[model samples]
Target chain A: MTSQTKAEQTGAAGWTRRRFIITLGAASAAAAGLTALPGGAAWSAEDAKTVEEEIKRLMGGKELADGAKIISMDLPQIAENGNTVPLEVSVESPMTEADHVTTVHIVADGNPRPGVASFHFSPLSGRAQASTRMRLAKTQNVIAIAEMSDGKAYMTKAEVKVTIGGCGG
Target chain B: MAKPKPRIRAPKKASKGEVIEIKTLISHPMESGQRKDRKTGEIIPRKIINAFTCTYNGQEVFKADFHPAISANPYMSFFVKVKESGEFEFTWVDDDGTTYSKKSKLTVN
Candidate 1:
């Protein structure tokens, strides 16, 4: 009788409880195996959106943190070389034992992964600072995000002007 | 690939409210493993500066993970606000577990 009720609940989603359990087992099996299917041949604007969703899902599906006061991004007004354009991000946070910046992610809009890199931090980090030179295929906005220990999120971004093609188009 | 010579350049000293800039560069080819060798006809293995970390007096100042997409001789510069004089150590790690490191001392003025 109890199993019948569980089956009824699963039936709402058009899945039998027993079938659902089997599907879960198969998913775990797939997760442990080298079963990644090759995706599309090329990246498009839709791919960019999907990548954004994937990264956000990696972050627990939280909305992007974007604001002006807490986070800031610095980039060259005009990139002399798309191969190595300087980028920096800093958060105005007092890195203390009780409060500190947790992580920062640099994502270029047009890149394949978009999420180029991420930095995890602790109170040991005296201040919130990170800088790196990045490769941009074309003019695009570089997004910088920061998560704080206090459960607050902040973001900043800047557009880079890419003049020459670096990928040898 | 050759062992990269890393540069660890930092300020001589720092005081409260002073922002100390740190500069670093490593001689690396930063191959993305996507291209084939001109002669060998085999794909050049992807090797890159995967991670960079900085610690101040046993505390971390900043850290970053790089990708093959980064340019050769990755040059990075960032500033840290000085609260007290301490030692700053920088470490760079490549994809093959090879680690290159350098350190400098900061004296509070």
Candidate 2:
């Protein structure tokens, strides 16, 4: 078995802004070797508008403050069954009475019931870790929202391929 | 059929400094409300395990809040860092006001 390099484990996201600057400085010392690679920034030229519209419909068309770097979503790279797929979400924030995960919402673009579920949390909740299996009618991207106690909204997503039907099968 | 009693697996005892592993599974129909029963020809209202919580030695180690997106017969595996040996109690509650509970013991070295 091969151990994953630390860089690989972090994915394209593992690099924070401060880390990027440090890496850039190191690359500058090596004669143009440190060029910044393209990042998965959440900038939308077109599709972003559509996603925003969908979000407004779901949230009463209120402007949603963007959330970055606070929420993480995990799922199987490939689901064995389209019917029942497992999903887990975690947010790196203290569940303090003053600052905790307020709510978590999971949505999918392809499912019949797109708004899969919404969980309301409070500071009494020692932590924000959710694990559950879902029914995916087909292959689609699953999205998760973590609303922190501080009124900040963070979003993360995963792509899953549903293999077999779970609800009817 | 009435819901079966929740099945919990445990050693009934554990010890200190050793991280204790716990597994929990609850028998739930986890109806998504989108499916129709073949025999009754009626819409199944959403009845799922909405959340799960674990308390060790009276302190909560983990908690999860769920949505309709979660599948049926929810099964979750997680661990708690054991500093002292005590009974770990787990409870899973459904939206229908049903509660399933199990307790395990641990001994500290």
Candidate 3:
């Protein structure tokens, strides 16, 4: 939270620039490591473009803004096996019929298909948290978007590096 | 047809209006169609659990739509509010149109 505020204080000079550089550096390093394995090049080349396209498709062409405060995604920085990447998603909501999360979408940019899963919820759920095991083809950002009942969307993303490809090798 | 084993874990009892955790696991290969046979080199047909749903006391609690990216023997955990004594109906739909289901009873005090 403090760092995010500091980033905001920089007004796109310090925070966004630093975050962008860090993300780019990490992505390149991870991509290099992934491409070293058999059939890794094909997976490493999948950039954030696919993830954006997927979010667009899932949103039905709806627009999305940064949801740093509303959604939280839990994933490992490095996955020993790509076949069973554990994921957990949680959203801030009251779980009341008046204002509750309606759906949560999961997407992996490097997978053969961008759409990984979508979870629906209601007031009966009591909370908007979901955990499951997912297969990852390579190093990529796994995105989670939560749709609220009042026609609003929030999202968060995490990157997972796969040592061994999960889908096929 | 052989039955697919679906298992669930939840509190046998809970206080009314208390939030509790629910866990589910189903035994499945969850074969994604992207693989090839080691010998014949033919594309393996995809067979995965595509959806999962849970209902409590006849009221829908939570639901999820999965894809080939889901691992074999898919396992998931979520939360629910227990209002009354009833059962949780857990269901999983596979790519082959197979619906595997199981139920667990809960007592709310």
- Give a tens-digit lDDT track for model 3, residues A33-131: 332222222321222236667677778777676777889888999999998999999999999989999999999888866778899999999999989
Best by the TM-score measure: 3
How do the residues B1-109 of candidate 3 rate in per-residue lDDT, one tens digit apiece?
3456899989999999999999999999887766655444344566778899999888889999887788889999999988889999999998778798999999999
| Candidate 1 per-residue C-alpha lDDT over A1-169 given as tens digits, one digit per residue, 9 for 90 to 100 | 5445565566678643232233433343234311121231232232233446635744666666665778788888888777788777778778776888888877777553455667766655566777777776567778777888888777677888787523221
Q: For model 3, what is the error of residue B88's alpha carbon versus the real structure, in angstroms, after optimal superposition?
A: 0.9
Cα error, candidate 1, residue B92 (Å): 0.8
- Evaluated at residue B31, the lDDT of candidate 1 is 65
Give per-residue lDDT, candidate 3, residue A90.
92
Off by over 4 Å in 1: A1-50, A121-126, A167-169, B16-18, B36-43, B81-85
TM-score of 1: 0.71
State the DockQ of every prediction.
0.20, 0.11, 0.27
Off by over 4 Å in 3: A1-49, B1-3
TM-score of chain A of each: 0.65, 0.61, 0.69
Candidate 1: give the clashing pairs.
Answer: none
User: Candidate 2: what lDDT?
Assistant: 0.61
